[model samples]
Target: MKRSHSNTGANPDVRVRMRRLRWTTFSLVAASYMLAFFHRMAPAAIASDLQLAFDASATALGALAATYFYVYTLMQIPTGILADTLGPRRIVTLGGAIAGVGSLLFGYAVTMTEASIGRMLIGLGVSVAFIALLKINAAWFHDRHFGTMVGLTLVLGNIGSVMAAAPLAWVLQFTTWNTVFIVLGGVSFALAVLTWLFVRDHPGEAGLPSLREMDGHEAHPPHEGHWFEGLMTVLRNRYTWPIFWMNLGIGGSFIAFAGLWAVPYLSDVYGMERVAATQHTSLMLAGFAIGAFSVGVLSDRLGRRRPALISTAFVHLLCWLPLVFALPMSLAMSYSLFLLMGLSAGSFTLSWACVKEVNPHALSGMATSVVNTGVFLGTGILQPLVGWTLDRAGTAQGAAAQYRLGILIFFFCVVVGFVGSLRVRETYCRYIS
Candidate 1:
């Protein structure tokens, strides 16, 4: 296959500049990913405001937050397809525009139905971003860097989650959630424009050779085949299932906690004020952001996937024991547990690189999406189950006593995920054994 050279015929200066361009493109895509996280976790910050605004019960409130996950879960496979076929530039641009509209609708809506619609739209749009961003990472950077880049992308994305925490509560003190989202909407639109102008699906499109080519692989980009064929190949793989379930567990629990329930859990169980509760929640997310970056780089350096996956998950399962039993602790201990849990949860990012490496090179986007579906699916299932369990006890705000059964169920999910992580065949960061 022929190589892609810089637009200036591989001028030394232009070639050097191209490296800078790659990071620039990554930042733009990461910004969109950040917005998605903001939307995912924003409901936690404003859960009370939503209750007062719509008179929504806990189940209803859980569903409202979960509305994003519902659409996002369903979008994963198709998102992979779009990322592969339409390319990251188009999909992210389109996703950004759609998400912008969704933000506007969400911010201004009064009724629960309207709010739900906005949430769904936001989910629908933002769902396209992460998968596409992964595709960009695969195409732009070397294979060895995938784990670190994935982790770093997640780090930036969690900045959005961080913002949705105490920072959002502080923002709401001065302005309505309505204003907050409307401004977010405008920012999304602006990002869409920047992504369109800058992002290239692969280096070849930007007048540069593929990273693999530059690294001496001399390989052509993998061709997309029949969707059914690709899907079945991935589905039939022994490795995919374990990682999928593992993600459903760790990723799901993280979303369930940080995305919606953690703040309220603190409030009801510990009597924390809203700002204080969200600040605690913020610590958990900060830990996740840091862990995602740190462990990803660590995994790459060690060149081992399964050990990292299993160890982090085991630690996560043990952390849940306290929460599952509602173990009493000092305030500092509680904050520390949340931080540790966040770190454990963030390790699931390894599953992304694992899934990609085990699948066909061309199918990386699709494979990544398949595993990612579990993250949202888990959240979609667990969040509502917690709400429903709370309702059964006639407790909408989820009093500590009412959360016993739900906590058990959450523990069960974690157990299953941990076991699955143990079952994952080591890829050792390559496509073939």
Candidate 2:
């Protein structure tokens, strides 16, 4: 069993400085991550706007939205390596700058091709945020504090998701989608500058004792300083693949729905106005945001990962039943289910802590990124596939039913993921390292 590290070794003044540095660095990186989250899901709110803007079909809209995931999926492993070696300071700052430029291009895109290019850039830029922020959390906080912080990071990032929902719906009433994206791009650029100026990857760099040097430090990597060695080590772990598949199913399904299809599904199937549907989507995301924190804190307190994760998966799986069967329900009932699904969906974050605990401590970024690749891969493929399904379903009257069918397929994928997750070895809050 691994021991917990003390984070109180530094004197009061130095400790205060370290705490400030930890939050400030985390805040900057998290801000960029928030933007990334925003861009990833923004398409959902503006599906109609985008469709009208380019006269795009459902498939085309999906392709445009999915371009982000395409680049993002391709970049995960490399970004993980970059985060591990090049460090979060550089990776996140560069990512924010690129994301900003992508946002600008996406905003100004008048043609479908141009919009695809912009989405590609946005994907490329923001792909770094998730892995990099995980690396940052690994560096600054105590192991016991790790899951909590990661959950909090998700909470922060999901704020962008929240913004992308009801708020974005509101904003669209007064402003063109292009203007909103352009302003977000500018914000991403500013976050980059702040990140560069204030963030450091390690406490030692800020003149504080490294967490390993603190009292009760228990885990130690068998190896370090070899770049590919760390990545290969993570890749070879038996438990890694199931978690990967789990991510593919869970995160992928969530991305497929919440990122693109959920709003349209609601509006089409239930005849919801855009605002009402967006509010439902927003509640779902809000539930996701809150659930991330609750589950993390609970997982930490109980010092158990697998049971909590499995339980969440089960609940999440159940949430899909209503959508899968297209069970008739009131708006209130639909909203309740969406919120429940969001909360259950957040169990995905626990996988990160699980992977982090089981792998070599030095390879946190590599492990996370490798697992993360599955997430984007799932999204990249499913978004377009669902769109294709919608387009090929035939006849205008049948389109709504077809969209519902796409969602049902996504539900089955989620089941596969949760079952696969059951096969992963439990870490119980202790690193094998």
Best model number under lDDT = 1
Cα displacement (Å) at residue 98, model 2: 0.9
For candidate 1, the 10 contiguous residues with the lowest summed lDDT are 1-10
Which clashing pairs does model 1 show? 4-208, 4-209, 5-207
Clashes of 2: 0
Which residue pairs collide, candidate 2?
A: none
Q: What is the lDDT of candidate 2?
A: 0.86
Give the root-mean-square deviation of each candidate in angstroms.
2.2, 2.7
lDDT string, candidate 2, 229-336, tens digits: 888888889888889999999889898899999998888778899899989888989899888888899899999888778899889999988887778889789889
CA lDDT of 82 in candidate 1? Answer: 86
Write down the TM-score of every candidate: 0.96, 0.96
